[model samples]
Target: MSRSFVKMNGLGNDFVVVEARGAPFRPTPEEVRAIADRESGIGCDQLIAIEPTANADAFMRIWNADGSEVSACGNATRCVGWLLMQAKGDGRATIETLAGLLTTWAAGPRAVTVDMGAPGLGWRDIPMAEDMDTRGVELQVGPIDAPHLHTPGCVSMGNPHVVFFVANAELAPVREVGPMIEHHLLFPEGVNVGFCEVREPDRIRLRVWERGAGETKACGTGACAAVVAASRRGLAKRRATVTLDGGDLKIDWREDDGHVLMSGPVAVEFTGVLP
Candidate 1:
């Protein structure tokens, strides 16, 4: 038996999207790991399984390269939106995930705009282990060059995130503190850590170390979370261009809708059969 798959990327955050609606078999953790293995398999930052849903849009599942089932993935959502648009000839769309129904729209050339719902900013909502005032978030990481790194703004973009404001994101010890903060006692569920530097009122530079998945070219939710965090900090405005390693994402936190709209490019890399 074989399954068809599409390899796509949103700002180089690659994904292998498998449409398993009519398929009889689901991918195992090991199999998902293999598919995301660049050396041995299809190669991707993550693997997305698209299954049928009842009350909502298509069911979307995320798997990390290590084969762990994750809660949410934003770039993959855009990639899947592109894949579905090509397959179903779409103008607008929605997807069901463990989080909730995610809405997407056809926008810009090679770009899909996703309404990533609202940012979840609560002590228990972000699902942090202990009780802390989310209105003014706090954390305890080892040594940071700056003291403020410990008290980053926290939010959940379907997945957990901790956005730290720095003078220069590149200078921050992403590889060092990222792992430490990701596995910190506060976030029992783990989290994607982002270092953000405000370039302007409408621009920010971010470098992310994703949870489950390590450093990648870009992270859509991370970008959104960063913008929201910056907005809360009075650094960046409601709309900001988040510059990631791969490219820029236009994030607009609509004043009326209250949805974080992520706009970015999606590119088809290749397609193959799953053996």
Candidate 2:
């Protein structure tokens, strides 16, 4: 049977969203891969399924391009949040995910702000293979004389992330080193990698190599992780603007509540049905 879907994007991280709140819509891993195929399928960084939740506005299920089911997706959350608010004709909405419950609100006509909640910093929370300091784990790349990337800060914004502070984001060798670190033994369940360049205390430049999605135009969770990591390292303020490949995001790590708020724009690409 065919299914209807909506295409949306938060920044340039796109998704094909299917609503199955009233009925079951389980797609096999192979099916998800086919739908995410850039050439033959609808093409998207991830596939989202919106299902009814007992405690929140809706439940969001995320599947990466590689057909891997993940716990969280910040960009996709914003997109789904905007859609839910629009449908309800309300400015606020809540979404439940494998990560947890997230609250969202309309920032503007096309913009949204999501409360991503507190980040997990413990090595066990990031579920690292061994216990280590998350602020600067003992992982490095390149020769002993000069490592290309080392001592990355790890954080779990629902999912696992490792942020590498680089002098220049453009020279971070994301394409070359991303896959290697993603599959490294340290992160037994794998991880998303972010190479960030702090331009100013209030501004940053970032690029992400998402697990299962390769390099995307943007990553919402990565941006949140970057800010949290940078703040912990005294590289940036608790609140700052993160500039990704697609656009900009305002991230605030609120001290009072310990919630990370992510504000950005969302766009509707189109709508369609599965064949």
Candidate 3:
């Protein structure tokens, strides 16, 4: 049999959005892994599935390269918005995921805007072992001064995240410290970790190590989580620009509606049939 997939990317974090709505086959974890493999398959950071939705545009499911299903993906969600917009010939998209229903709009020029819904701030939401304050939880990884970085603000952007507001962005030892903290004992389910530096009240620098996906070029939910962590700590405003290693994304956690809005561009790299 044959399979069809679309190559898509939000910022630089890319995915293979497979529309298996009416197809004969649903991709197995092994198949998804093959498709995400750089040496064998299509080579994407993640794989997305657009399935049926009872009352929404479609169901957006995210699978990491390792074949683990993830709760949410902001950039891939925008890519879904772009694809669905083209299908309906309109400029809006509403997608259902494990997180919830998300509303999206097309911004001018290459960007699409998505209402990612409000973040869930709690130990259980972030799925920590115990209940700690969301603003700043006591989490010590390695040491103190030369420590392996600690005290992260835990939040859930449909999935779990731990954001560390640091004094430096580039020198924070993300590659070393991130993997350790991600699998720390407190986060029994494992967690996506973000290192953030507040450049301004409306701008921040972010680097992320995602659960099941490692350190990708970019991450939308990580950016949203960083913004929320900063906002809760009074370090940043609700509306802020988050600069990732791949590119920049605008996030607005609306005060009135309590929805987190993310704006970024998605690129369709290529498409092909699966054997």
Candidate 4:
């Protein structure tokens, strides 16, 4: 059977979204990889399935380009949220994922704000291999005395992430160091790596190497995690603008509620049928 799909993107982090609310659509890891292949398939950073749910507007299942199913994806959430809201002619939508339930609302034309929930800061929360201060874990790359990168702040925004504060985000060896730290022993389930350069108290630049998916134009969850990690290290404020390769995102770590809010734009690239 053939399935209809939509191509969507949030800050260039693209997705091929399939709606299976009325029917069951289950694809194996290899199938997911084939569909996400740039040259042979539809091509996307992740594949999203909008499934039926009892408690929320929809259930979003995410798979990386490598075909690994993941618990959360911030960009995909915004894209799905926009689709739901547009269909219902409503301003808000709730989505369920393996990570948890998330609420999204229209911020503007094609823009959305998502309640990403509170970040996990404890050692066990990040699920590191050993106990240590999450603010600045004792990990280093390169030389022992003066490593190229050291002491990254770890946080889990539904998924594990480690942010390395750098003097210059553009100069960081993201491709070289990212893969090394992603599979490091400290992160038992692997981790998304972020290179962040604080430009100001309320603004910064970031780049992420997502686990199972290489570097992309943007990563919504990574942006939220970067702000949270920066705040923890006194590098940036609770609320800030994160500039990624694709575009910008406004992240607010509410002091009162402690929930991180991510605001960005979503776009529909096109639609197609899957054979």
Better of 1 and 2 by lDDT: 2
TM-score of each: 0.94, 0.99, 0.96, 0.99
Model 1 residue 247 lDDT score: 97
lDDT of each: 0.86, 0.95, 0.87, 0.95
Cα lDDT tens digits for candidate 3, 60-133: 88898888888799889999999999899888989999888999889965689999888989788889898789
By TM-score, how accurate is candidate 4?
Answer: 0.99
lDDT of 4 by residue, 1-275 (tens): 78999999999999999999979988999999999999999999999999999999999999999989999999999999999999999999999999999999999999999999999999999879999999999998898988999999999999999999999999999999999998999999999999999999999999999999999999999999999999998989999999999999999999999999999999999999986
Per-prediction backbone clash count? 0, 0, 0, 0
lDDT of 1 by residue, 1-275 (tens): 77888889999999988888896446788888888888888888898889988855588888988788888889999987777776677777788888889888889768899889988988777779888765456665555565647678888999999888889888988888888888888888888999999999999999999887788899999999998888987888999999999999999988896789999999999889886
Kindly report which residue stretches of model 3 are placed more than 4 angstroms away from their true locations once superposed.
144-148
TM-score, candidate number 2 = 0.99
lDDT of 2: 0.95
lDDT tens digits by residue: candidate 2, 1-275: 67899999998999999989878888999999999998999999999999998999999999999999999999899999999999999999999999999999999999999999999999998879999999999999999779988999999999999999999998889999999999999999999999999999999999999999999999999999999999999999999999999999999999998999999999998999997
Clashing pairs in 4: none
